[model samples]
Target: QYNCEKRQEVKHISARIINGNEALPKHWPWVVAIYDSNDTLVCGGALIHEEYVITAAHCFVNQDAHEFSVLLGTTLRTNSSQCNNTPKDCNIQKKTTRKTEVPSKEDEEYHKASETQVICVGVESICTPIQNTCCLFMKDIAVVKLKTKVNYTDYIQPIGLPKNCEDPPASSTSYSVGWGRIFEYYD
Candidate 1:
């Protein structure tokens, strides 16, 4: 009688995009979203290799890989207002040397008012793990090599890794955004 799956996603919908040179573990350079088979959201991932996705490593356990879905190159979870296969009605001022002239203030403001028009962020490449690693949570780190490389586009590209493999300072602020109070944390 109701789309219960959709309702659940509304409560669990926490997805993100990683575009440009944003450093990760908080800010993703590409848009990453984890969803259910019916297109309900769950969490985000940082692309580590072609198909290798580095996530909490605790997110994939107790679930069938076939039941999970990942959508890349978008900030907002639901797919809406995508025209010409690009975002539509975006609310931000998008400027590039390629787009020489800026739109009028009214038009600019109107676009800014729209939530779907901004450009899509990109993740160079990411993948599914060989198996779900949750209970043990062996490594907080994870890598997902893609089944096939994602086609890159403007305003989106691969993120650069830390220059040194060494860990950052403890004072460094890192954040994790995901759905479910059922999450497992690691060092």
Candidate 2:
């Protein structure tokens, strides 16, 4: 028997994250920490499918697909304590990037230049940004492909995507999360 209907619900009320807080284990299982080749935490992403992760396109700027890694099953971005209990290894199999044509000459030129400079996941297919418009200034979304099929666990899982084009009710709650320093500006 499955307990999906009566599980403890952990959710967010808005899309903005104010001061960082400790997330509980198995609470936000889809959340992941994106890292560069140097093992530096560069951004945050959510697992939306067994082989797909959604994150910001800006996160891959000046970065190569081979130089990226993702960490799951943990709350602290820089620590591996959560995965120590398990012996199985988790690996990222692939990454995908969708190119969108921006509106400004300056912005468009910059994006084109950057695309030439950095090689993102292979261009097997192209799609627009998650927003209704493909403007980079406002729409900064990307979907990354993982090479291996994800094995769901107590700390790692996939999130559900919207089924229709309609917007959510204004009363609905949304949550946004990321990995970063506690203070954005320090004197």
Candidate 3:
């Protein structure tokens, strides 16, 4: 069974930060990196269930399901090599310990003795919300089905969802974390 309540606390001071700081290992365990057929990082998603991920519909607007894959259990955005050449060739391995690569000297201090068990899986299908054609951003969410069910671990888990269709308190604060372009024309 999957546990959705298994999440680490996230602290945010302001509504937005110019460039966010690096998160701690396993801090956002449900986060996954979405890659294109060329194994290039396209977007970031969250594991909502054992076999499902929630990402933006715009990320796959005209893309095929076979052209995408999800990488789980790593903090490095450039960890596509861990997925091997293709998603089909990637297999779920037993818990194995391996040192996570730290790209820069600054990141080394944040990831001392860090380890990660990366899993790469192909997308079986994508489910998008039905909406009018007038607006492109309307109902821009998508649910992606994974080719294989993920085995949960300390570094891999599902995120919790709201039980009722109720709005959050007016005083509530929310935070979003992902790897993406800093500005519209940056990347």
For residues 1-187, write the lDDT of model 1, one tens digit per residue: 2221111111122333222121221123344555544444556675443344566555555655544444554433342222123422221122222321233454454333432332322223333345444445455544544434544432223544565687768896444443333334569
Please list the C-alpha lDDT of all candidates, in the order they appear.
Answer: 0.39, 0.52, 0.71
How much does each candidate deviate from the true structure in C-alpha RMSD? 14.7, 14.4, 5.4
State the local distance difference test value for candidate 2.
0.52
Question: Residue 136: error of model 1 in Å?
Answer: 3.4
Worst 10 residues of 3 by lDDT: 89-98
Better of 2 and 3 by lDDT: 3
> Model 3, 154-178: lDDT tens per residue?
6788887777967768896666778
Please give each candidate's TM-score: 0.46, 0.62, 0.77
Off by over 4 Å in 1: 1-27, 79-140, 169-187
Model 2, runs deviating above 4 Å? 1-16, 79-135, 183-185
lDDT of 3 at 179: 71
Least lDDT summed over 10 consecutive residues: which range in candidate 2?
117-126
lDDT of candidate 2 over 52-83, digit per residue (tens):
78888877755566566566655544422223
